[model samples]
Target: MATFGKYFLIVWTILFFNFFMETQAPPSCDHGWTRTPNGEACVKMYIRPPKAWHSARRACRDEGGDLVTIFDETKSNFVRDILAVNNTTTAWIGFHVILTEERWHWLDEDGTPNYTNWRYGYPDEDFWDPMVRAEECAIAAWVNGLGAPWINYVCFVTYPYICEKPLPSKCQWNDTVCLNIHETYDGWKCLKGRDGVARIVWPETYPPGSSGPIISGYALPILRSEKRRRDLQ
Candidate 1:
């Protein structure tokens, strides 16, 4: 009986230590990124180096992902916060107005913009006149002096690109929301769920008492089955 009690106590101690380590892990990326513990699901990358739109997509694919495709306000704010932290005026994202001239859509290659986070008066496609049909692909970048609206650029032009991989589903919970905290060349910071009464982080700092709706309240669950398929491939 004495030996059994000692072994039980030892097991309990080990379990406690493991739990502590799990919760105390430091924030994974830098200001604009995160590392999910359950393999690739929790990790993501954001880049804005110049490249043609098609080229950017290819680069992401080659690197195991594609240009950034924001699915919710939290994700959008996260990316925006990173930009603000780095004082990045412009960068490229994976969206464009390809169909019917001005009909904007995400460059998903999957034929759907199921998730969208467009700014006011977006998808204007003003840059493309009927004559400019050939230049349909779009890239996003900071338009210095133009505030936070990431203006579309011709894909052929070289710029940085961001890459992302599905993070482990274990790190995510149905009841929790995630927000981007900060970003740097190394990685980014994403906070999960609201901490108590604190409002969700807004990429655009809002003035006090000027509340309307802040977050767009959309969530994109990383498709686990899709990831499984990729892993098998």
Candidate 2:
């Protein structure tokens, strides 16, 4: 019983440490960018005078992209990576309250508010417009440009637009499968078997077929079960 208690305590301590480490880890990237071995898809805009939200959208559209939309982990990581790399505290994103109050939308082909990555205490109507009932919104960098933080800005104030261009796909390989490492993408690569041996392939050199350690920066390795192996093959 004492031994079991000791082991339990050890396991609990390890779990607590892991949780703290994960929580304290630095943010991987900014709010609306993604990273890839090939390159990065960034929310690029100028640091000129302020612009309204609509104007900002137009500027991004003109550049073959929209303001910015972080729909998933890939996009989120990409943005975080860009911000960290540039040491930028904040920047503009593609989100604004359009017809409805507090109902944000992205100024892109899909003008829907599918996802949001706003920081704490955001979308505040600090600067109100009597003429417009709905509060206009735009991404602001460095919190009023005073300090290095994120803030929401009123639309109609002209600022440079940030755009996102899709990155081209690259070839990726995994222990069990070969996948097309395209931009804006995600998928699994391997699975485990009942035997406990991870069903991974390290292809033999100069054999019947092209085989080697599947290596693609984008490709992920996974373990497969016997049943999955048959189906995948």
> Which one wins on TM-score?
1
Best-performing candidate as measured by lDDT? 1
Q: State the weakest 10-residue window (summed lDDT) of model 2.
A: 178-187
lDDT digits (tens) for residues 155-218 of candidate 2:
5555554567544222122122222212112213322222323223233342343222322222
Per-candidate local distance difference test: 0.48, 0.47
Clashes of 1: 38
Cα RMSD (Å) per model? 16.1, 14.8
Error of 1 at 132 (Å): 1.3
For model 2 the local lDDT of residue 28 reads 32
Provide TM-scores for the models: 0.47, 0.42
Query: What's model 1's lDDT at 41?
Result: 28
